[model samples]
Target chain A: MIDWFQKLGRSSLALFERLGRGGLFLMRVFAAIPSLVPRPRLVIIQLYSVGVLSMMLIVISGLNVGMVLGLQGYNTLVDFGAEESLGQVVALSLVRELGPVVAALLFAGRAGSALTAEIGLMKATEQLSGMEMMAVDPMKRVIVPRFIAAIISMPLLAAMFSAMGILGGYFVGVGLLGVDSGAFWSQMQGKVDFYEDIMNGLVKSVVFGFVAAWIAVFEGYDAVPTTEGVSRATTRTVVHTAFAVLGLDFILTALMFGSV
Target chain B: MIQKRTQEIAVGVFVAVGLAALVMLAMKVSNLSSLSDQDGFEVIARFENIGGLKERAPVTVAGVRIGRVKTVIYDDKSYDALVTLSIAAKHNQLPEDTSASILTAGLLGEQYIALEPGGAETMLKSGGEIKLTQSAFILEQMVGQFLFNKAAEGTGESKAAEGAGP
Candidate 1:
């Protein structure tokens, strides 16, 4: 009984300690931002690696997801003699929920895991320490640029995802199925409001990006400097980011789309 | 140096394409392009009941949308629904005595305000009140009235049958 109680206490304490460390690490990254502004190249390069590289994954997944939505929606809507509303259903589902959530989840697995692994490997090889020895702030040079790149790229990727998804939906809805092209486009335009639906979706993606990037970098920086440790940190980054993105999505949806 | 330049170009293209997608979403998918860039005047109409008539619903004339429902408010004193409409400036020549009625799009779709022109010398200006207005047809009320009529008819037929037998 005593051993079990002690174990529980130890685990709780460890959890709190890790949370505090992560919070402080995030603060350091924020603090490094002003210094980072002078050098845009670092951010640009990171953007190329993180944002540009992930484009294919986001776009492809978005298309497939949208096509699936179109197929499923058509089948169900046809039963109720509401196949005309397929466009509305597809656009609403993609813009309001799936677009941001799926993009962020993919971003976490793709760019996020890579970020953790890269940073962990750098630590294992003592590159961070080498920079520190040269009187360079690793946070400013290394972490901040990557973090900013993530923030910049996320909304753009999500926007692209939604756009591609809409196209995919259109192709499936109009081209494959016999739904009227005019009706599909007109219905989507009439129903989906720019502010209520699109802007709110952008907001959700931005938040997800922030959280995902934060977790990725923090896990990497905090990893134990060993080969096995680096692998573990990468896994942790992906798992933690996935959970955070999904949980935050629900909260954001409630706050943004909840009122009406 | 060449490698660096190509990479930078790729990044630029990526950003541009992404922004283009956002624009397409705004212009093509959503109502931003259609609704924005127009300064319109507001007009008011009162209805007995507005039945699912929401704000931002289309205000149409002869099946053509000219404006949108700006606000829907309940009048405390008259117990009527006062709806404000924002009509585009280009459509400024609508007659003052135009009739406004609530209409549904499809069988069970969105409700919009339909306006019919009247032969009047005067034209509707900002804040002008449309005098002739029709309320939305409530489905439940219609069904209830229908059932009541059927019951009344049945009772009358039974009474006639009893009288004939006696």
Candidate 2:
């Protein structure tokens, strides 16, 4: 029993330590934001790698998600003789819920893990230390650009995902299932709102981007400078990012949609 | 150097498309594009019940949208639901006798206002109130009313038979 108590104490202490470190890391990143404006080249490179490179994965998953929605939504809507509202169902679900959440999850898995691994490797290789020795702040030169790029890219990725998903739904619903193309488009047009559905989704994506990216960068920076430590940090980045994005999505959705 | 330039261009394109999609979503999803940029005239309508109708719901005339619902209010003294509509300026020729009805898009879709034009020469200007209006038809209320009437009739018949017993 005494051993158990000691273990509990140790874990709590470690948790507190990590929390303090993370809070400081986040502040440092925020403080580095102004430096990005003067030298956008650093930020743009990360954007290309993180944002543009992930496009292929996002597009593929978006298409598949749409096709699945079309197949499932069509069958269910047919039961209620609401086959014409297939577009509305697909569009609303994608734009309001699935698009942002799934995109963030994908972003976390892809870009978030990569960010952690890359930074972790840099630390392990003494490159971050080398920058310090050269009197360059690694926070400004390394972490800030990636963080800003991530926030910029997330909503764009989400929009593209939703747009592609809608097209996939159309292909399946109209091309294969023979749902009325006109009604599909018209119903979607009539029901979906700009402020409520699209704007809220964009906001959710941005929030998720900030969170997921922060986790990735922080995990990398905080990891012990070793091979095993870097690998562990990468895995933790993805896991933690996924959880944060989903939990935050729930809270934001309620605030945006729940009669407020 | 060329690779970097290409990457920059690609990012720019991606951002541009994303912004366009956002605009499309805003306009199409909210159905804001249905209303033109032209200024519209605000008019008032009162109903005994607005049902599930919401503000920003489209106000259409003869199956064509002419405006949107600007506000919904409940009159304290009169105990009636008041709806404010903003009709398009170009379509400002709605007669004073024109009637307004709250309708659904489809059987189980969103509620909207449908205006039926009347054969009056005078046009309704801003702040004009549509006198003849129909409230939303709720299926639940109709079913409740029907069941209640049937039960009442059955009880009444039983009472009459007992009173007339020989």
Candidate 3:
């Protein structure tokens, strides 16, 4: 019993240590925000790498997901003799939930992992220490731009995903299934509420972007300067980002759609 | 300098695409396109029950949509749902005595208000109250009543006689 109690206490301490470190790192990022403002060029470059580079993955995933949704939604709606409502189902599912969630997941995998790997590699090369030796704050020069770029890009990527998803749904529903395009669009227009569906998804994506970027950069910056450590940090960035996105999604959905 | 210019162009394209996506999302989600009924006049309708009736539900006349539901308010005094509709100006020729009924698009699809014109000379002005309104069809209650009636019939005339046993 004593041995078991000792193990539990040690694990709990480690967990608290990680949480405290993460909180402090977040505070440092916040402190370094002004450094990013005067340097639009840095932010723009990071945005291109993080946001623009991730576009292809987001669009492809969104299209496939929406196509599948169209197929499945059409089948289900047909059973109720309401196949005309395929557009509403497709648009609702994408705008309210899947677009944000899928974009975040893809963003974590493509951009977040890349951020972690790049930063981790820099740390492994003693470049971060080199910057410190040169009297430069690596947090401002290195981390803040990437952080700000990521946060800005996410909602935009999510919107693109939603738009492409709608198009994919249209192709499947209207082209293949022969659903009346006019009815499909009109029905969707009538049913979907702007504030409730679209804005809610945007808000979710923004929160997710902040969390994912924070995890990616922090894990990278804090990684031990070793090959194994860099790889582990990259992996952890993806894993942690996925968990954070899903957890935040559930809470946001509850807050947005639930009777709160 | 050329490299910087190229990078700036790429960033410009990226920002432009992002803005396009934003506009598309906003238009689709909010119905903010040219087709949206921005300039519309208000009208009121009262119903005993507005089951599954939501704000922004279409108000159609003879299957052509002319307006959208603006709001749904419950009047405690009469226990009626007072639905306000914002109709496009082009559909301003509806008679004052026009009747409105809540109808489903498909059998189990969304519900909307269907207006039927009456043979009245005077047209309804903006903000006119549509006095004749039918409530939405409650499928569950209808099904329950149907089952009850079927069970009663299965038991024959004895159940009916028992109910009239005064």
Candidate 4:
């Protein structure tokens, strides 16, 4: 039993090592040919997919999160006769952790999976092979554009999420709960720091984008022509990328903030 | 080909608008910060203990944040907490004999400094220290006291029943 457990652990470690190496290799390949691709066009496509398309989800989710936080936080603060601090609590929680992480996860599920499947289908159809045979590097042509797009998109989406969430908290806490709006905004302004919490969230989004794109591309490139293979790869890409993003978020948060 | 081109164009426009929205939001937040900075005052309070009183904790009057906690320092000589607060300049004139208390937001929430104004003719100036202060009410102690009181009540009730019995 012990030997079986040890073997399981070893296999898991080996799997992670392979993934890390593969991700690193893809990053390097894309990094080496920066100027070879059309930067502006790729960035525009990324902006559309990551930012504009993501706005509705970001807003809805952010508002609900903010409202729930305010409702819970206000109740607790009222007990100690410090209900006015609800604004600070809501804002800090939104900017520091919840907003960025949730936004990234949503983005990964919505767009990241699609990106992987699209690339996977292209691979299965021999299009990528044809591009490579014709001396058009797949990394520069397909992967680079998606990579650049995701990096740009995730941060912008996170910022939108944070802002919308704060507004939602404001409406629920001040308007619905009867807490003073002035007090709420003032407390939030006084307590929250853009450089520390908000900036950290943006940086995390950038990293998430990279992970999502890499997973999609890797799965797509390795996909078999069979329908089942494409379906499995797509599912794996989304599930694994989401978990990886969450795990990476915790490590980055700890490193950036130093024990919360 | 037309559909693809149009989709790409639509996406491009969407990205522009999203970026613009973020920039505007940032500008608005910054503006709000500056406005608050221009109009605020300061006061000082002392406490026995400030459990989780952060630097930017709100100072509320009737559940309104008229001020914020500026700093917290330990005074070894008096064994007290010296908390400085920044109030909105308009609300600067506070009664001389005000009471300051350390309060928790919830069961496990953050703590803050609460100011209760006293009925006095004279107003306090900047750097003035509030003398009458209350420390945070520890939850464990409160729960312990309640349980003990309940047990005592039960014992007294049983003794009275024994005395009344044949």
Candidate 5:
């Protein structure tokens, strides 16, 4: 009983320690924000790696997800003789839920992992230590740019995903299913409110981006300076980011959509 | 790194594409493009019950959309629902005696305001009250009234039979 009690206490302490450390790291990154503006070049490079490279993945996933939604939504809505609302059903689902959540998950798996690995490898190689020795704060030179790139790229990527998904739905819903193209578009426009649906979705994606990026960088920076530690940190970044995105998505959806 | 120029161009393209997608979403998929800032005249319509009539619900004339509901509020003095409609300036020729009715699109769908043009020479101006207004049809209320009428008829029939026997 004592051993079990001791283990639980130790683990809880470690978790709290990690939380505090992550909080401090986030503050430091925020402090480095003004310094990042002058060095757009660094951020651009990071954006190319994290954002540009992830585009193909986001777009493809969005298209496929949208197509599936169209197919399933049509099958269900047709029973009610509401096939014309396929576009509205698909668009609302994508914009309000799937777009941000799925995009963020994909981003976490792709860019988040890459960020963690890249930074972890740098730490393991003592590159961060070397920079610190030269009086260069690696937080500013290294972490801030990548972090900012993640934040900037996320909402844009999510938007693209939603747009692509809507097209995919259109292709399947109107093109394949012979649903009237005019009805499809008009119904969607009539139902999906800009402020309530799309804007709220954008807000969700931004929050997801902030949380995912913060988790990725923190996991990497906190990684032990060893090869095994780097690998573990990369895995943790993806896992942590996934959990954070999903959990935060629920909270955000409730806050944004919940009438209560 | 391939080249600084190449990297910047790629990033720029990515940003551009993402932004374009967002614009498409806002304009095509959503109703943002249809949301115009043109000046419009406001008209108030009083209804016994608004039902599911919401703000931003399309206000149509002869099945063609010309404006939107600006507000739905309770008029404590009149003990009725007051709906404010913003009709587009181009549709300013609507007659002052026009009748507004709360209508549903389908058996069960969103409710909107429909205007039937009245045979009048004067046009409705801003802040004008539409005297002829109809409340939304409530399915449950109708069903309840129907059941109540049936029960009352059944009782009346039994009472009539008893009097005839006596």
Candidate 6:
């Protein structure tokens, strides 16, 4: 029994070590600068696909989340005769914890998976190897444009999400719920600090963007150049990047707010 | 190519409608609420504990927002929570002997100041202080006290049973 337990522990350690090495490799890929400049056409395509295309989903998700939070918060506050505090509850929750993190997760699932699949297909077809033979850098030709696009898109998406969410909360909390609209706005304006929560959310999005792009690209590039391998790589990239984004969010929250 | 173009247009229209709805909602919310301004009349309150109390938390009296908390500063000399409240012009008639308490809206909710007006004839002025204040009632402390009391009762019951058995 003891021997079996010891073997299990060793296997777990090995698994963690492999995951750590993979993460480091992805980070290095992100840090590497390409010799050739990314083409404007590629950048535009990436921007459109990742940013503009993502707007509807982000807005829909953000609005619903806001409405739910408002309803739940109002219900709880009504018990204590503090129904008016719903504005602060909704605004603070949206700005601090939900807005950036949820947006990042959504982006990772959608754009991040698409990126993985595209690159994975190229690798399976030996296009990446062919480009290398032609003295063209695959990372420059492919990864950099996507990386830049993801970084640029994430902050904009997060900002849009936060704005929509606050509006949604207001509609449900004040308009439908019969709470005075003036009171809600006043409470929200007084409590929310743009510098502290909003700026922090934007900064977190940049970091998440880098992590999501890097992981997807790395997984796609290192895939076994087979059809089955490409599919597996795409799936793994989305799952791993999503979990990593959530984990990093917790770490950043703890570091930023723990001492306070 | 034509089909793709039409599909793209449809998606664009959908997104535009969604964005418009969100904007309309925002305008409605903004128009409805009134926030207290800084440089207004101030009132000070004391609290033992203020959990998750942000600097700009609203100070309400009987569900009406009369003011906002300007700052939450700890006075070393007094060893108490010195909360500075910024009251609106309309609510400037708060009595001098009004009681202030640190209250929480819900379980694990944000903390705020709840002002209970007193019957004093003299109204508080700018930079005046509220003398009577109650601190936040911590749920954990209450639960701990209850458990301790229950344990004491249990011990007393066991002691009586032991004596009767002898």
Q: DockQ of candidates 1 onward, in order?
A: 0.89, 0.64, 0.55, 0.20, 0.86, 0.08
Off by over 4 Å in 1: B162-166
**Candidate 5 clashing pairs, residues 3+ apart or interchain:** none
Candidate 3's C-alpha lDDT?
0.89
* 1 or 6, greater by DockQ: 1
Docking class of 1: high
Fnat values, one per model, are 0.85, 0.65, 0.53, 0.26, 0.92, 0.02
Least well predicted 10-residue stretch by lDDT in candidate 1 chain B? B33-42
Best by the DockQ measure? 1
lDDT of each: 0.93, 0.89, 0.89, 0.76, 0.93, 0.76
- lDDT for B1 in candidate 2 is 92
Q: What DockQ results for candidate 4?
A: 0.20
Better of 1 and 6 by lDDT: 1
| TM match of model 4 to true structure | 0.66
lDDT of 2 by residue, B1-166 (tens): 9999999998887678778767766665556677462378988999999989998888998798788898999999899998999888888889989999998877777899999999999988898999999999887898999999999999999999999996
Shift in Å, residue B32, candidate 5: 1.0
Please write out the lDDT profile of model 1 over residues B1-166, one tens digit for every residue.
9989988998998899889989998888999877962589989999999999999999999999999999999999999999999998889899999999999988788999999999999999889999999999888888999999999999999999999987
Candidate 3: list runs displaced more than 4 Å: B34-39, B121-123, B140-166
Residues A1-260, model 2: lDDT tens digits: 99999999999999899989999999888888998788999988998889989888988899999999999999999999999989999999999999999999999999999999999999999999999999999999999999998888899889888988888899999999999989898889878877778888888988999998899999999888999999999999989988888889889988999884
Q: Which stretches of candidate 2 lie over 4 Å from their true place?
A: B28-30, B35-38, B148-166
B1-166: candidate 3 lDDT, tens digit per residue: 9988887888788778877987887786556563468688888999999889888888899998898899999999988999999999988999989999999867777799999999899999988999898989999989999999998887888877888897
Q: List the residue pairs that clash in candidate 6.
A: A181-B32, A181-B33, A182-B32, A182-B33, A182-B34, A183-B33
lDDT of 6 by residue, A174-219 (tens): 8889888877876676555555555566678778878887777777
Q: Give residue A50's lDDT in candidate 6 (0 to 100).
A: 71
The first chain of model 4 has a TM-score of 0.88
